[model samples]
Target: MSSPQRSMIAKVDSALTRCLCVLIVWLISASIWLLGLLSLSDLTMRIFAYGEGWSDVSWAELSFMVIFAVLLWRHTYYCRYFAIGIWKGMGRLLAFQGTLACMGLVIAVFTVDVEQHLGASVGLLETGADPALELGELGFILLALYLAAPTSVAKRLSHSPVSNVESAHTTAEKEFTV
Candidate 1:
């Protein structure tokens, strides 16, 4: 194919890839938000009742989340598409994003069951006047974030370049022209 054809193909692929990446990014962001909400709910419930210690299981869960965050805290491959091209600025952006993700996880973990800082432990959308409604709020927030992440990303990146779908269509039409 000619260079224009090739450029067209590459740009189309890139645009599609960006759309997919945006989706994936939103998914990750949403998951993080959900986890935070879960922690918030747990914290709220345990507030007024008997003091529940961070048992072996809670600690285990915490440690696991902590470790998982640490493991995923990588930034060396953010802007790299298919591991082929590596731009300095893109790499830096990736690193920054990765770091931000890790930081978000850390913040969530620290405030998981800490009710004082966040007001209530449960959510406030509940029907009745529950003292610790923050948990419910947290759940809603978490769900909202996760669900909204993809939408937000898609909306943000909607202006991304159009892929070869149009070009392919044009090619097909021209092929039938003669």
Candidate 2:
């Protein structure tokens, strides 16, 4: 009701909103990474299931999957820092890589019959849920792309008010010097 109480409520509300946003971003990013991991496992299983041995498998594809999985995992871990405005340059680079990884995932999803692999692995031969699964994955991929975007999550959360004071001080210095 009072001014101070209103101000406190506003601060608490903003903090809660920020935390919720971060948690949502984390869930999305982590889910994407888990998809990558699942894909990698499927590939590994297929290699062992059909091939005479590991040597008979396609090394190139296997290696690519491994790299993709690692990138996704790392991106999932680092995105939290990125969201909080730490190591922005590294975050941008990782985000770009994450975008590329998502694209790679798109290709893999379409080309590799991921549903079949997933179904087989889980002992469900024909659930007929391919369309739904694909749509969900596509949605997640789009979310990943959104997370990778440069404009999103650009604002740094600074608790200190000194930055405002410092900027004003610099502006005053410039005006007096000129």
Candidate 3:
């Protein structure tokens, strides 16, 4: 291929890669947000159930859910940087959220009766709340975690010539200053 053709191809490839990365990040974020919303809805239903009027603990739980929603919203906003090939701690944020979700879902699967706890409320699966649905959600969380892992991010960055160039420039500066 000619030089201009190769350069054009490279630019197109880079754009496509960026778009794919952004799409994946958006999908992961949206999934997690949906899960959180469902949980919040279920909790609200339980709190308002007959003979289960809101209490101090119920208020605390609701507050925590609100905080979680806010944090997730912020993280979603920060995801815009990923389109420009900036990590900006978004990977760490994703890993942390994914790990927490995995642990919470595992515990819920083992200890809580999914149908009983959810109480006719919709769940992540949309069919009904069940251990199998929780497990499916767990699988997704694990996949997100794997994708956001530091090693995985590093590997992806290493393949980018811009990252390599930046690293080399920084190394050269460090060597000259020392």
Candidate 1 structure quality by residue, lDDT tens digits, 52-170: 54542344345444543443333223223224334443333333334444565566566665655677764323456453343343333333323322111113444435554445567
Candidates 1 and 3 compared: the better one by lDDT is 3
Winning candidate number (TM-score): 2
Q: What are the Cα lDDT values of the candidates?
A: 0.46, 0.56, 0.54
Q: What lDDT does candidate 1 reach at residue 57?
A: 36
What's the lDDT for residue 94 in model 1? 39
Pairs with backbone N, CA or C atoms under 3 Å apart (clashes), candidate 3: none
| Comparison by lDDT, 2 against 3, better one | 2
State every prediction's TM-score relative to the real structure.
0.27, 0.35, 0.33
Which residue runs does candidate 3 get wrong by more than 4 Å? Answer: 1-6, 51-99, 106-178
lDDT of 3 by residue, 14-70 (tens): 999999999998988767655544544454454354555555334434654565566
Q: For all candidates, what are the clash counts?
A: 13, 0, 0
